[model samples]
Target: MQVLLRGDWRQRLRLISGLILFAFATTHFLNHALALFDLQAMYEVQQWRWIVTRSWPGTIILAAALVTHIVLALDKLSDRATLRLPAWEFIQLALGLAIPFLLLPHIVNTRFARDIFGVNDTYLYELARLWPDSAVLQSTLLLLVWIHGCMGIHFWLRLYAPYRKFQPLLLLIAIAIPIAALGGFMVGGRAVAQMIADPKTFDEVKQLSHWPSPDNADRLAAMRLIVRLVFAAMLTAALGLLVWPAIQRRYWPHFIINYVGAGSANCTFGPTLLEISRMNGIPHASVCGGRARCSTCRVRVEEGIDAVPPATFPEAVTLASIGAPQNVRLACQVRPRGPMTVTRLLRPSTASPADVDEAERGSEGIEKPLAAFVLDLRDFTRLSQKKMPHDIVFMLNEVFAAAGSAIAVHDGWIDKFIGDGLLAVFGEKHGIEIGCRQALRAARDIDLALDHINAKMEAEFGRPLRVGIGIEAGPLLMGRIGYGPNVDMTVIGSAVNVASRLEAVAKEKGAQVVISHEVARLAGWTPAPELLSKVDIRGVSEPLEIVAIPRGRDLPASLLASIEDVDERVVGRAAF
Candidate 1:
């Protein structure tokens, strides 16, 4: 219900009508392709096609869909704040608008002639009339309709992952259907031309079609001309809307949209902030175009925020989902009703596949119970003080790689690499109990992996590298957070802070690993009573009871022996 409410009703209506028209076009193309088999086969399919399309209900439905689509298209055009559009969007629009003009003639000749003049419009009769002379026009019409419908379908489905995964297959089908239809059309036309060369066959086709009187034929031709002129006028009127925004900005009441740190755009009342940005060539990010389905186009109104109207239901829902402040609004959805200063929330360069995930993932930004693991390199300042910047970076990379592999072996997600340490979360899919167990196992593995690194680097550093590992389990809000390209999956909760504090405690006590009591209990591990101790942690009201291990190599061999090998797929999937 919420999803439906967030949808633009006009867009939904347009898609429905477009799909209906595309279905009609598909059936027509398939019927035409039947001509490859034989004219009799084409006739048989055409008859079945007409039984649905020529029926009273089908005719009414098709006509209603056509009118609805046209009216909504022109209405949307009239509402545009600028003529600027993405390349594919412009191409699709141009193709769609050109289709009606090309299609008018075809309809007037066949369906209109048959309905009004009682003309028997069959493949034999129409092919005889249109064979070689009007071949170019017919072929162009076929391509235009098919291309327009395919573009619409493409735009509609491209947001889905499944469509993108199978796009190559779909593209091949899109290409093959048109080629087959054109081949059938050309073959059938050639056959008609050969038969019509015989004067007897030509006369028979004309008589069989119940050739209309000269007066009725003239009337049909005149009506066709009149229909073409009217359609041309409508299209011209629609195109004329492009100039209205410029005219309004010059003479009508407008607003100055000040984009802090960039510039300002003088826009009329109708244009969205995003449209104004594009019109004036200001860079802004909008991964989902202006559909209000993604939050990338959001802007913070720094000044005169109260002057901006409230966000609509869809816009409000998106902002709320992202936990955006009250002053922020989607640049695409909000049309400035008054002068206001705004700041774009995202950089255009930050647009990426992650934005698509944000749009499609229903559980994005939700909270779940999980394990937070924090690790810190021991004596990191002393180790790096004597080394070159490049040398220090290389050493840190080696340490991170060892730690990262251990986390991965246990199905943990490496959230981010801190300067000398890292944060890893576990059990996004398997639950917190599994997560706690995985995180504890990963802690011991990290220590063991670093031992190998230490053996290699001991001669150069004069000492082995050491790290402090901390693990805590609790409910945490895990999701992507940060500005633009810096956005990353991270967890936030008391458990995260407690885990970090435990890492510090491990370094101070010279212990290889430290974990809150909750982690051990959740993982079902029973350490020695001597290793169990309590330490005061900042922000934690009570002293946290924890298990401290003096050496990672002595972290209970039974724990490792009892556990199964970690599933490779469990690692690096999500921040728990």
Candidate 2:
């Protein structure tokens, strides 16, 4: 058997249980859709529902998921340091707890009423009761459950590229399902109402409304009372959890926690710095939610540093890796033993590229594998020597605009601009193969786009501009570099170095686009090569065999197409 630690097991449990619940909801909604046909069709579908859901295997899974999910939720609440949460998160929590309350009566009257009281459970019966209530409760229940589940799914799968790509389609489906289900109910209810109103069908419709015996009514009343009492007890337990935090705050030693700079808040100890920041409506950044996975929430203890708690092992490791100073402590991990002044290190403003006040703020540095494309103007440096600075700047912007558009169409992004060239990366958000293909696509587009730029600039400069691109694939560190206002996204590794060196050698090799063997192999690219030669690249212990294209526009017609149809191969190349 495979062994799992505490965190692993808990995550697995939550994921498995959540999936089971979601499956049940999906089947339930599909059954609701059958009502649009007629009562007979709906009840027939309900039989299938019972076969799948009430069967021993399905019943065990459903019951286990319900218990496990609740236990985990309560466990998380009990262990929580503060009541602070993002609005969506808080809403999801509230909706999750209220679901059983709103659904319990409906469940009892349908399933239990049928099984125990000999009452018929059918689409007409449910819609007849629901139609009179204007479907207010049913609609509310459906919307609440759907919204909560969607939010959970988004949080779970947003990191995966496929999920993010299909999110729009998923959202449309989410919206349409409930609308169709509820609309079908309304339609079916109207049809039944019309039938009942006709004098000929009036008695038959009345007979369909099966009434429970007096004994059954008494039992139902007692069951409802028990449900209410149990629900009340659950609410009481949750209340106790909330009150316990306050009780501890009152009795425990008190210390004032101060937030400095923007989004400031003041709160008492009996909570972590992250706790006070979130609970007091301060926008603190905790990507891992105070899990010590990152140093994002680190605060510089400007004064009374010693008064703060010492660094835990996780905090120390994270801080050291990011070169944090001795005075800096992770806000999430720190629990002040005495009054301490601190500031949130990471805010949404710092994380955003569009913030007006902090527009220059760059993303934190992280290492990742990326496809690097370094393209250099063949003669722009020499051309700029004779031209005015503003003219050169304008010309370069025109060139970049064309090249940038080409890269963008294929999901590539410019990391930085060199003096007469640009460094771009692909697969920052996509997989490795896609990134390589994107680089090739960009190469072709860039060559074609240069003609447009040259057409605009030739009259002023008396010459056409040409560019050489080198595409290489390898492991690399990508992140915003530099301190203060000098920060910009940069790629650093053999991939970038090799691509840059290749650009430097393009003119000598009589090529406009050069690709490392590694890139060609990974992208499943194979063009009938004019020549394949081992060439010495800078910073490489061994010379690399590279494939050269005389011009980007002259790339093989099947370059991108082959990436999809061709099987993968291995062709290693040395670095720059």
Candidate 3:
């Protein structure tokens, strides 16, 4: 009983309800587009109205489904509010809530009036009466409906692979359809007004066309046939798309059971887990409609771990980064080939412990000496602009991989990648001296990696890649900020700013690697007599002692000469 309400059931309910609402909106909009065919398509409109609004069972179901959907949405929104979502998310929710409020009058006037009061007005009569006095209200309602529906569809497609592929095209069509429909309404309304004002000239001008009349028997029959065929085709396609995946599982047989515990149930497996949980009733969290993207439906495999297949790449990456235990897995991502006992790890009020720990750590901190390394790839923007997007991505992957490998090999934590630059922190978990040594080793390794990359690029693209690196050791404060899921783990202090300035100086001096005297002292490395120089860095009250590092034994003798010229130029600039 706990298993059913725990995760999968909630997600499935949200997905089914969302899709039903989407289908309802689509059909309703398409029906409005009928105005494009004729100014007085009252017969077709009336037929739709009778079938959907007049039938007792259909009306009841529509009301019930809408009420349920709204209630569920409000519940979800309240949960998100507790998490303190961004301003944009809140704005979107506000707009979505406004939709039903704006729509209530139209629904009550048209459907409720006809069903409860037996005021079976023609489509033209209803449109004419509603358009003049309620134009502003009607326009506002239409805009709200279209925006809310599109936002829902956008979020839904983002979770599904098939829909994701056609997102751009779907967005274009979604935007254009509403424009075309609104334009047709305006044109059709004007045409109808002209016909009513001068009925003598317009021979076909008629009042209150009724559906299922003897005069329109053939048209009504054709309309019913088309509607039925369309509904059948949609139903068939939807079923095939959804059900076929499960049926194919018979041969491929990918079944996974996850256990989520609220203290009492002994971990169990199989279809019975879902069935029993639903029968007994238990509360679970599955906010993303059971899609694998939302990891809310996660469980910890407590026993029979070998029964589950290995985690997929995305699942593994997400889990490992968040430092989840080996047994922890998203229920939607895992599929069991055999029986497995699982325990639910999360509750409505709590997230993963590791995530909570990181969030807490990010907020509390103090200034301490840390080693910083910065690397900037020269002329990368121009290089990227010349290459195709796919090729550019390949190049960037290679570059980042090489740089990251160097940093990791020297025991540094990659702080962040800034476009074509790399920033890393050394000895984050160790003392300042060790951190300085690690940063220096990382710089040497990066030079070696760059040489290899340049050689390969020269051989392949007939061009070399150049980069500048800088290392510094100083005191800095590191912490985390931001709200909810969007928190940033960040470092702050004069040390960071100084490290960046040194990197900029490396570029100006045309040197491969530069180190501040502070870093050299911290690492217990004596500055080479010929390589030492003093320069006034921007924003610093005192001039800093700097050293330029040469690449390997193959260093050009003229490198020292170039450094001398740069030093003289800096002095000249300072004098001026």
Best by TM-score: 1
Decoy 1 TM-score against native: 0.71
Question: Judged by TM-score relative to the true structure, which candidate is superior, 1 or 3?
Answer: 1
Instruction: Give a tens-digit lDDT track for model 2, residues 256-359.
Output: 66666543455556567777677677677654445454555667676668777778766776666556668877777777777777755555333221221111
Regions of candidate 3 where Cα sits further than 4 Å from its true position: 1-11, 40-57, 77-83, 197-323, 326-576
**Per model, how many backbone clashes are there?**
0, 1, 11
304: Cα error in model 3, Å = 27
- The better-scoring model by TM-score among 1 and 2 is 1
* Global CA lDDT computed for model 2: 0.71
lDDT of 3 at 112: 45
Candidate 1 has an lDDT of 0.80
